[model samples]
Target: MAVGGLDLAKYCSSYDFNSNDVKSCSRAVDLTEACNWQKQRDDLEGVYKSADLHSGICLDPKGKDVGGIDDMLGFCRQKFKRTLDVRASDADGKDWRCVMDIDKDVVCIWQYSDKSLTAVQENGLWVCRRPADAASP
Candidate 1:
């Protein structure tokens, strides 16, 4: 199954992240963006254009209607585990470990040497000891 002209066959024969394609093509496309609708529609649309395909909406790997943005996000979350890891260092020499969720949203936070949170994403800015981090702004 191919979504937006992406040969998901290399990723999976089906849309479920449990398929072999997940292991095969996870590096090709951010499975997170391919899965998330609200945050990725424009980006996905660009891929669609490059492929000379226009479906108006992003399709699931299996070519089924994803219904809506919320539904698509939920479906991907339910199907895939956190599939991305990114690391960096802060200006103060603190380490930052960032994990990209199934939805391609980066949950990044500065950590102490032992890996304890020193600052977290809060309303688009990094703040110390904050809860309820918002998506990148």
Candidate 2:
């Protein structure tokens, strides 16, 4: 709903989408935004809960650096022992650690050395990238 930047009432007022169809899309948007927010919050909170999380990358279902997203997530359970809910953004070949607000879902991303990362956002989106596991050594 908030992410789509569209509302059913407003969409129906315009003639492009049928009022009935608009409800489905609006609901989809609402669900997506809710899911995204939920996942990201969980992932960050999981990391924050761990004293051991900072030593290496936490490979999560949503933030894999390669492959199509669906396939990426499939590898998640095998490669890492945990699943954390998080939103998706597209990027590869970068790394970060994060200090997160468990309550608000806001994350402050940082590099391995604890310096901040330059957020390479597109439009209004921000993504978290982790160092290549092979490259970390």
Q: Which number leads on lDDT?
A: 1
**lDDT tens digits by residue: candidate 2, 57-77:** 223456542211232232322
What's the distance in Å from true for residue 108, model 1? 9.8
lDDT of 1 by residue, 15-129 (tens): 3332222113221233335435454443332123133222224555566554333343343443344433321112222211121212111111212111222333445543333
lDDT, candidate 1, equals 0.30
Candidate 1 ranges beyond 4 A from true positions: 1-71, 78-110, 113-137
TM value for model 1: 0.18
Candidate 1: worst 10 consecutive residues by lDDT? 103-112
TM-score of each: 0.18, 0.15
